[model samples]
Target: MIKTAFALSFALSTCMVLPALGAEQFQCPLPSNPNDPAKLEQIRGLLPDVNTMKNIERLNATIATLRRDGVSKSLMIDHLVGAYCLMVVREAPLTEAEKAALVRRFTGQVTRLVYSLESGLDIIINVPLTPDVVDAVNSVAEKQGLSGPAWIAMTIDDALQQQRTTSPPELPAGFSSSC
Candidate 1:
């Protein structure tokens, strides 16, 4: 279980990078619903194979980049899962014990960070977009045969990915804020 803030950060990496237990958010199971799993799978497919040490280091480096960018903890975890574990749960034939560990891995990390006020089943955030943006999302959603909500979720993930790639690395040590 996670103990300190350091442990909390380490947990994020291990949940995807070190785990035999693959995770979904909120300590939940890998989704059985085709709609969401399909979404997860799409993100999953877009990532490099994370089964190697170099890829693990690459993902950990991404966390460092996001941290420097001052992203929220939830967004960090979301990206970690998307970048590493989504492909895992889909492709690996895990045992029952492994699945249970998956549940524990996320639950432990989440327990250290948040208190739940809603059912895990309905754990979601409502984001408000401009009407024109909504119309564009809707048009694209319809063309792809995806529900509006699902497409929006996909778009958010895409935006997060863009943010991840574009965030600049840390400045050199001599570039002091002490001016």
Candidate 2:
């Protein structure tokens, strides 16, 4: 009985130790002082060669600022780290699908970018769209008998109305409204 107990303890201890030993050496650091150049340089060194080091640095700074602006969640920090790393190293902007995925991951909603216009004002907001999207929007606008901008405005208004009719806002899982 003693021998069996010893074996079980040993197995459990080894399982715990192995994970610690196999853990990654370099983690994306979220140090208290993000502006520290020395620490930033150390993280920069861990990355593979990429042409957009400045972009990475800028993204890091932006993340740090965001965290300081009261967004403190480990999952969000990790997501931002992964997203920025992939974005900079890949040397390409995230595709529309990728952006949607990121937004869903972070926000827990399948939402489009919504803009608000002030009531009783004739204002124009310039939203640049990809060529393909522009073509699609133009087609839809023509079919709806509205200008492209008017179609977009109507769509946004409809979405807003739908949200208001819902009992409560559906937020992302694990989302803290404070952030």
Candidate 3:
């Protein structure tokens, strides 16, 4: 099973969703990193007072631009999910019912977002293989206690490493890499 970045997502979403003003529930008094208090404070201070429909429209447009500019799906989804949370939270303060609704709406999307990003955003390929090829892959993967997809990923990574090490790097005259 793939894991979601819900912990990070929730923290970020909560921070973006509500105005810091008069919102004791939304405030993070103590920075998570004592050494990075400045950074944390900067982040806290930056959450927008986005209470208007126009702001939501602008945010959505920006998200679309990011997608077009080849931003990672995980990041795009993170902001998209955060924006959604912000809209919902602005509709009402942080109540148990509101939180539950947010979770219900976003849980699956977040899970998929994390899984795709973690997997390098590679489209899953279901290759049509001969019986011999299937048997070969299944045999090796089973020996290593891996699923077929996991084994394929590992094998590709191993092959890439081998290629990198075996291939000579182009160097200037009188220069050589020690790597």
Candidate 4:
């Protein structure tokens, strides 16, 4: 009986340790092209680590700024999509369907690029938009249209505020919000 208990405890400990051992190391997959060093630097600076939710919020804010500055939707989407693809390629091996889902999931940012050849041609050819993209679409969909970028930023801020208020955490001071 004691031996069985020890074996169970050892199994439980191994299971807990496995996930921590497998946690991915995040790296920005910014392009190396020097033709537009500033743009590349900005992209690199903006890329998020896997562990940080703040990076996602920061991307939304940046999109808001770009929209305010009158950057075209297509242009912004193109750059963001490219960056997203690079990130996916760098992080993990995904099936094409998974890649499309990732694009759908993080449309404002193309978080994954390389996908399995088996999923479909669309995943290969199409660029997926992030939530920011959804914001852009919604903006254009409106008759008097709120600016897409502004809409995205506001939406993200509201969501973050909501998250903070609804589920207060146990640690990290200043993490809570009244919103």
Candidate 5:
């Protein structure tokens, strides 16, 4: 789905919506390395601020500009997703609730784009995390070559690998067994 780049119309909730990309070879505006200072500057110049980005309509216009200026679909997808990921990790004066809300909405948008899932249409997961936890997740995600919800899923799976209960299930007889 790298080619998809989340060019989609989200279902349910008034979150962000992505625009469709066209088939035409063009030079990408941003550089390959996202960590480069120049790349960050370019992104800021092109995409505007976090508040502006929350507006789907404005974001669509920006996407149009990017497409017109030539941005690869894969890069678009990563940056769009990475943008929110990067924001949460920043020292911006955002509350825990604000950060969680951003993540929830962004996650929903991506899930809809990639899987065509929606509220009522299908099950959706909205993970709300504390500011410290969010930043921690983002850092670990980068180190592990994972991103966004994939990191959440992997971490959750790791924790749940050995299921535990408040009380262990009882054996049928007077005999008990080891896990």
Candidate 6:
């Protein structure tokens, strides 16, 4: 009787644990083709913020330019995904909701860019905007009385700098620069 009870308990525990383990497994599917906007949107729905969204948009634009310049779609997608990972790592912790928002935005933008590239869309303009790329774009946009890539770039740069400031920097031996 005790053996029977033990077996039942073990079975139940295994069943419960399996689902929990599965739940923790996040399998992000890379689109089969770079032009599948829908698939990209699905992936983007996992990120955290507006700045991330903007960065993804800028990246998409850049990728589109690269595609026009003869880069392959697969390579472009790989590069974008790599860039996304870099940005996420560089940025700090985010709430669940923020992360979700970022994912959604990134997925959508990536999808669109992929589709555009696949369709052989012409590169309208290339804006090399980074979180640091903002200042130049902003200065020009401001003078022309329009918001441009610089605005987002500057915003990201400021936020990232603020993050850097809040966190203590690691000092090297014999480095006497003020913190």
Candidate 6 stretches greater than 4 Å from native: 1-52, 55-57, 96-101, 117-179
Query: Which candidate would rank higher by TM-score, 1 or 5?
Result: 5
Name the candidate, 1 or 6, with the larger lDDT value: 1
Q: Name the best candidate (by TM-score).
A: 5
Give lDDT tens digits, candidate 5, residues 1-179.
21221211111112222211452321122323456565454555655555544676765665555557665433444455555545553635765445555555554453324322223765458857778767766664543334656555534432332233345656798786965
Error of 5 at 85 (Å): 3.8
Give the C-alpha miss distance for residue 61 in model 3, angstroms: 8.1
Off by over 4 Å in 2: 1-120, 167-179
- Candidate 4 or 6, higher TM-score? 4
Tell me how many residue pairs clash in candidate 3.
Answer: 0
Candidate 6 residue-wise lDDT, 1-179, digit = tens:
32443343343222211112325332233433547564444334533333655566556556656666664444454445534543443445654344434544454355345544244564445645456545654543343222553233323333444457599776799998767
Residue 62, candidate 6: C-alpha displacement in angstroms: 0.5
Error of 2 at 55 (Å): 57
lDDT of 2: 0.41
Give one clash count per candidate, in the order shown.
0, 0, 0, 6, 0, 16
Pick by lDDT: 2 or 5, better one: 5
- The 10 consecutive residues of candidate 3 with the worst lDDT sum are 1-10
Q: Could you give me the TM-score of model 1 versus the true structure?
A: 0.29
Candidate 4's TM-score: 0.34
Q: Tell me model 6's lDDT, rounded to 2 decimals.
A: 0.44
Clashes of 6: 16
TM values, all candidates: 0.29, 0.28, 0.31, 0.34, 0.35, 0.33
